[model samples]
Target: MVPDAILQEDGPLRPNLVTVAHAQYRVRAGALSVVTETVALTKALGRVLAQDVTATRDQPPFKASAMDGYAVRSQDLARRVNPATLKLVGESQAGRAFTGRVSRGQAVRIFTGAAVPAGCDAVVVQENTLAGEGTVTILSDGLKLTRRHVRPTGQDFNCGDVLLKSGERLDPWRLSLVAAAGLDRVTVARRPVIAVLSTGDELVAPGEIPSGDQIFESASHAVMALIKQWGGKPVSLGVGKDTKKSLLRALKTADAELIVTIGGASVGDHDLVKPALAKLGLELSFDGIKVRPGKPTAFGNLKDGRRVLSLPGNPASAFVMAQVLLKAWLETSLGMPPRQDYAHATTTAAIGANGPREAFLRGTCSLSSDGRMQVTPFADQDSSLITVFSRTDALIHLPSGSEAKSPGDLVDILPLDRL
Candidate 1:
């Protein structure tokens, strides 16, 4: 049997009334450093940067025309009391430069993105010019027009400027910027390697019919999907029986920086995970977080500095713990940004709290006719039920010590899809 001291709430961590921020701080402080590698820019999306990316050359690199028009001297157009006739000296297309300069009465036929020729102060759009024998006539007075439709060199960015800072997660748009800055490759933090295991003697794998006392397998695949969604590489460690020896062997052979065990974390006779982890020299960072569907959660670090997170066996509890705890811990360890998008909603019905622990009730949020955020909790919130979570879009956090909430009370909500 596991020692009572290891399973019981002692002095410093007693009361167990921890806020979300406090839990995140503890995980961050204990997170391990992520491995890194250099990958091609095409595969760098969704990966965090390991080093600062600098611009190799100025964007645009030259003064270019913004429209299809004639490049002319602004002073020459201003001096003319009447419409001026100028010769079309040459044409400047993208990627090809015009070698000659423009003189008086000479204008270059330029297209959009073409480099502006020397001595030309403005571009008279082709629409504003009338063509005749060997010359084009400027139609309007051209008073308000200025010299050069030129997009000056380095207008967007200068050379040696930091285009992207270290620790930024690259997305499609960020990749476009890196390509525009002449980068073909990028250095990114290696994906966090995670090992997933499910624990229970009553569970059997799918496709195999269980005996009269056995139930269908649970928690492993669902937890693996969540890990993938959060950008981690998952390795299946299979299911372990509810015994200390089996659990110990699973942890010993798993090759990952992080290990996630599903189920057998509560204070039940069958809860062998806590004892198994302790026997393997795992230091208890904290156990029993003050949250609903996840109150029995456990977090620790192996003697070799790897992380071990023990989540409740129920599918709903496993998912909730992964979202609220595992996501934040992995992101911070890998230098990824914290997800901060949350919506405020008015509760449509009354909600009662259990006790000191904060409860995350599954609910659907929508915009009302008056533009207020409205949230309606699902009828069933049992941790064992997974069907209700499919219909939920947000988790409504109920603060501790609150007995009940009436209609119209504001609640903090975390969106399901975004996280």
Candidate 2:
């Protein structure tokens, strides 16, 4: 009999997720062939920044009044018990500054956001002052003559300050910040092209009627949606049959940097993804992971240096692996740091003892009675069940060879789809 190791398709390759993640995804940081483009801020939303954005000018550019009141030289109003009166010089409204400087015993009418007139060190709110025809009296009642009502220049941010760093996603608020920084456009990383392909002749494309032995291809559709959400432009390669020729034809058409092939990664006779890709000179990184529902997940690089991530056929399995590994690739390709959303949550019930493989069980996280976050893993953890996956908001992570966990045991949880 042949030794199992000698007969193994991938030789002695078997690694946990950590080794693969660090070697391929994390260690090789920065970006992959980073192509930058100058896009209008209006259309920059959901795009990754390729360059650090600095402020063109100081925010509030001048010392302005924080309230609508009188801008005065504090010395004009002594700290005596009696209120001191000052002559009205000029008014400073927003966008209209008082050109003349404030002399001794003189006050300027300054509205909110107006620049503080020169030689003025304090602003008295209208509520704390008595307005007159030609003069304003500072009420001694509760008025403290100081710079409290003044907003110093560059209070928010100084000129040349790095408002947004590289690799930041230009969301709504981030776009607003850029606009405030006097930028009409921004330099951002080009969205990586991630081709989502599915395998097997038993899978029929959506919008077509499936035969009695076939089911609609759903994994690719879901993965495409996720890819778009993660800032990758996803293209569909449709369904490839079990034949090596058909699979090779479909694979050759994928001109993307990363091709995520769903299904046909196992050792079954119909499993032809690896064999077909091997014809194209695929160097396998690892044929299997030490994780349930994704043990068949495989990562490899072609002769042309393009990488392929093969996932299981089950929709739930494909989705989990995509979240775990595919997102890391997408982030690094876009020059963004790998997001680690792992958190600790107490289990609501006693979890069963885990086997040899690390498990990511579908579950919901909620606030417990004592205001603590708790996770409840679904009773049925069948990999093929998309219903359970749909209702799940978090993945309850259980390490390999872990003992059965009792209620209230803290377990690592990964929030799903930014939930």
Candidate 3:
């Protein structure tokens, strides 16, 4: 295994500057596909399936009614002109089918989801009925000739049909469909566990004002929330002071498949994450990415085959790196597809970029009158400004060699959400 620092050697051709695409490629290449198991359908929401879900039984299972109405033979109703009255035989409710077959001139009072009896080809809602003791008359013209509000068996799905594919995330609405297909459980991927540690000697937890030179702690919890949003279980390891022993102990004790350390990957003397990870026999992939606010980001692998990501102390940079790299890594580990909602949008303001690396800018994306997306960068693009990212819906990627983009220029915008 290669040490974490060995991957960052400055080469004449590669230049040691890591681009967003290259960082993502390296992270994805190390993804270990997690194991999977069957979970009850009720608990399967938000989980990715490990196996294709085939319908065990046909949806609806039988011809059924879709409305609270009267079931009748279309031929019997068609024989009468104007409002046609039919004798009411019996009532049919959901889960209990009307066993008696409907002959000519006969109708069954059926509620929604009730199985349609044999010989019935149409249904008329009860609200359109004019009742007279044993008979109900249709009040609307053409109602007797219309075939309405009747659902056929296997209309949704058939037995053995594929309902959901492997690697697909199941939502509550999708779980309902699985239940409709008579499946009580589903096979889904195990959720990835992530351990987060905040490292800094000058930092103190929130609720406690720094007595001397300490600053209020930030970034770890925020990054943890981002991990949760990406479908990973995040465990906060609290704060680790600037010491190799403390950092090393934290990395060794973490019970997660992925360990994240915030604030100690830089070259400062107090930054001990890199050396601590090195002492534990971790193979470093890269120590820095060629992006602003996050150039000091580091990645490595633990002795036990777990992955470790060390992010910058700057809150904004940490968040940007997490969104750009960690999100993709978690998705790949869970067998999910890459997010491709990135599109070109007209820039509403001029912005500068690093000449050699793509810059991700926080911007608000709005639909223009001409039905095009317009991305406007926040006035303050500083790496420490966390508020700017909160108000934005997408990240505007400014490619290399592009110094500044004027208004109306077409720039690539990656949508923050799947929507």
Candidate 4:
């Protein structure tokens, strides 16, 4: 039986919610292939690793001091009859090791991170020692003498230890780890070049005066930011006017593995993205989905094998779908599997029954009084409301035919990527 909900005028039967989420993974669908490249560690941030990152050398290659004091043999500090004192020999500063060795009744001045001198098994912190002419005295502060205060060789990691596995995105902390691994370069997945095209006649770029009834195009800017955040190189194709020629021209200039089209994807008279690309052999995969604010979203590939993900023009719709879909697609192209981005959380307010389409409601999440994860859906869910999305930290997901949810009811949530 044909569902009356999906019997739209000019598009194919809208796919159900499950198919909408799973079937559109064309980046990993034997069309777009993941590419690998070696990049400098400085330029590797936000790029995915194509190979496992191994530590090139042992951290703290030698026994290192964890405190700034004197390095002495433990027997030297255990003097019972005589005061705990030793003759100061030499100083061991960081990156400058002392040549002479420590013997009984002898100590070497060592700073933090300096290599511990040989024949020394313990460190007496400067706070516990009183400096004299050429010798030092360990004060009887009534403290335990068990603390060696020495970082053993390979304390952090050994040479050839796998620190990062394949498909891990390099963030600042991860980059610092790689930098500390004695590496100047690393092999990472080449960022997929994704082109963003905004199509409309009544839209103008920000900073321009909206002459008559035009509004500023905002979705493409947010999409480009998302592309880079998800490890893809974003190429902006600017705005394509509401004409076949305009869209085709913009589409032709997309030298990218994926083209993300915003707006002009519905059955309306001005919706010409499909028609414009049809002239260039646009193959359709899944045309429309049964989801609010993103029903016009579609996925396909062109004759040249470049994949296209058409999104709605509205900023909220585009941004939400980008979080849900584009994030997965880009990760897959970077050799990572699409993550399960949904989890269950308690709703703080009552929610009415959902319509036929599965809805993703913008919401804010926080720990409640008892530390349970709780979410509150925004009052207005208009697809054009960018302000609502700006404050949204999570998306409360309600499947089609879902019953009204009371306060404290558990619901599915998709957390937005704040980065």
Q: What is the lDDT of residue 169 in candidate 1?
A: 83
Could you give candidate 1's per-residue lDDT for residues 101-192 as a string of tens digits? 99988888888998988887678888888877767788775534764467888988989989998788888899999999988899888788
Error of 2 at 334 (Å): 1.3
| C-alpha root-mean-square deviation, candidate 3 | 5.5
Winning model by TM-score: 4
For candidate 3, which ten residues in a row score worst on lDDT? 1-10
Each model's lDDT = 0.80, 0.83, 0.80, 0.83
Report the lDDT of model 2 for residue 356.
60
User: lDDT tens string, model 2, 1-419?
Assistant: 11122112233335444433443453244236678999988889899999999998999899999999899988767666788788999999999999988888899999999999999988999988898999998888525677778999999899999999999998899899999899999999898888877998899988899999998888898899999998999999999999999999988878888889999988899999999999889987767776766778878788887788898998888998888888777888888876777899999877777766667888898998889999988887778888888799998877766777788889999899853
The list of candidate 4 runs beyond 4 A from truth reads 1-18, 24-27, 78-83, 370-372
Question: After superposing candidate 3, which stretches have Cα over 4 Å from the reference?
Answer: 1-14, 369-372, 417-419
lDDT of 3 by residue, 262-356 (tens): 98888778888889988878898876887655788878797889999888988878988888888888888888877665789998776654455
lDDT of 1: 0.80
lDDT of 4 by residue, 1-419 (tens): 11223222223434343344554464346335678889999989888899999988899798999999988888766645445878999999999999878877899899999999999887888998889999988777512466569889999999989999998888999999998897878898888889999989899999988978899998898999989888889999999999898899889878998899999998899999999889879888767777776877878888988889888888887887788778778888888866787898999888887666677888899999998999998877777898999899998888766777888999999998885
The local lDDT score (0 to 100) that residue 304 gets in candidate 1 is 80
Local error of candidate 3 at 52, Å? 1.9
Provide the lowest-lDDT 10-residue window in model 4: 1-10
Backbone clash numbers for all candidates listed:
4, 0, 2, 0
